[model samples]
Target chain A: MKRNVRSSLGLVVVGFALLTSGMAQAAETYKMDTEGSHAFIQFKIQHLGFSWLLGRFNTFDGEFVLDQKNIENSKVKVTIDVASVDSNHGERDKHLRGKDFFEVEKYPEATFVSTRVEKTGEKTAKITGDFTLKGVTKPVTLDAEYIGGGKDPWGGYRQGFEATTQLKLKDFGIDYNLGPASEVVDIYISVEGIRQ
Target chain B: MFINTETQYGVVSIVLHWLSFLLVAALFGVGLYMVDLTYYDPLYHELPQWHKLFGVVLAVLSLARILWRILSRSPTILAAAGWQVAAARSVHWALYLLLLLLPLTGYLISTAEGSDLSAFGWTLLPGLFELSPALADWAGSLHLWTAWGLIGLATVHALAAFKHHFVDRDSTLIRMVYIKGQ
Candidate 1:
């Protein structure tokens, strides 16, 4: 009985060592095609319980790993500059970046690092990640769909995807009280990556 | 002349008492109204600035008031029961504590996101710490609850004074308000 416990403890130590040293990955890494201006992170929400107001973050970069044989092993990491939030209207954008909304001067960046990726269908997956925004980190899930991958005209191999998610403004520490109707914002993203 | 005697409040004590109470009342009223305003309202931004401005004023005044109370003698309670004396002492201590607590917690919440707290074109407290969301949330909860606690205790304190004047027919309330020596 004691020998059995000894072997179990040995296995636990070995597992911890493997996790710290980074286990071998069987996925291909791809860099986001941000230089070509082919990526988008946009959001929309109800404006004053009457109309929809749309906005997008213009500057961000990310990378993803795709295991073709097993999609569950895929990983994604993205960093977005919160100061780049643009609603097209200059005056409103100024207010959005101020103390009322994002407070970009204080919290300059928002980031997402995937913790789990589960393949739900042949072309769809659920990506759960820890998303940090406005100095608060919360777990968020994105419903992602895989698009086609092909060789571009510039002679580079590329893969494309689209995803959607929703976030509560107050949950991210943005408690500016924009009324009950504007509580949640719908996020839409289209990412195209180049094989590296 | 500014020090309290055996049976009467000093001029300084009376002034501090009225000033702090008036400040607390104004701050609490403005705080309740400001937190509920929508983003579109002009007062949404204006009120918080004033709130923090006055919060700084209260923080300094409350500290000075506590110091003065410690350095001076308090007038003896007249026509009071044993339980009333103890309750009044406890209530006075709690009021002073909460008065200081509101601003301390407000400082933590305001500076949590790495921004210095500024009031009336001057920086009151520097953001010496980094961004701390957990501390910010904790302080925010404390600030909200303590505001109500302070107001509740102040009401009880006032009622106690009224009880002394009306029910007990004593000179307790009059001593604090009415001044002598021209």
Candidate 2:
């Protein structure tokens, strides 16, 4: 009985060593499949505090590192072209890209860099990141759900995620008062990436 | 009565003239009214389609009218001094210029998104080309100022017609208003 216990304890220590050394699982770096149009950063805000104004940033590229063995080490980085803001209406989109809103001429890009990722559920995580927009940086939390992952038709691996976050217009230095109800913008992100 | 006779406007010219006037006047009134509309108003969605459809109509008719004016002979200026004749001619050309410009600038504004614009449930025209936002703003400004200018010039044209009818007692206004039975 003592010999059996000693052998079992030795096996447990070896398993722990392999896990701590990260030799059993390797982290994968995935590039967003933006060229295939499988990613979207969609947003909606109240219009004049009366109705919804739907829009999206058309051009963006991003990548993420998924450490399955340790999700805390996972990271994400994304950059968006502010000039590609499309709100369906030409005049409104133009106005959004001008000095009144995004000021794309002055600051043409918005970026996000993840600082921490905490697993909240089997298929969900809370990703905390520094989101910079219009030259203002703030810590934002994204409630993310892993959608799916598998081999692609071309013999490549792919993973997908969906996330949601709410941002205040004033937090990004966008002080243009679009009225009381238009102050907060709800963001929904659906991202699909290819293993690279 | 279907063609010009150098003394009176024919039936076609009279019809086209009144139609153009009515369309332009309606567009001016509607466009002015739309500027004050709130987002929730049903007319906010409905009015622009009708407005743009009628704008297309005006654009087509304006081209046809200009072609007709050139192809057909014009009636003589009646009971007018040389300066009055010059003023009338200048006003006519200015009106033509505005008719063409208002539609073109409006087109520029609509097609800036590089997509097709719909009018009254029909695809009117694929954008000829996409315009930059700055250029689109310039187009909008020109559309507004030229619309105001068109309304002003049209008013002057009408006042001159009334002057010939009421003060000068000439056939100038009657010729445009009436088609000879013939």
Highest lDDT against the true fold, candidate: 2
Please tell me the TM-score of chain A for candidate 1: 0.86
- Pick the TM-score winner: 2
| Model 1: per-residue Cα lDDT over A1-196, one tens digit each | 9999999999999888767755423466889989988889999999889999998998999999888788999999999988778676533564577677888768989999999999999899999999999999999999999998988998888889999999999999888777889999999999999888
What C-alpha lDDT do the candidate models reach, one value each?
Answer: 0.85, 0.88
lDDT at A27, model 2: 79
Root-mean-square deviation per candidate: 12.9, 7.9
TM-score of chain B of each: 0.94, 0.96
On a 0 to 1 TM-score scale, where does candidate 1 land against the true structure? 0.58
DockQ of 1: 0.07
| TM values, all candidates | 0.58, 0.61
The candidate that achieves the highest DockQ relative to the unseen native structure: 2
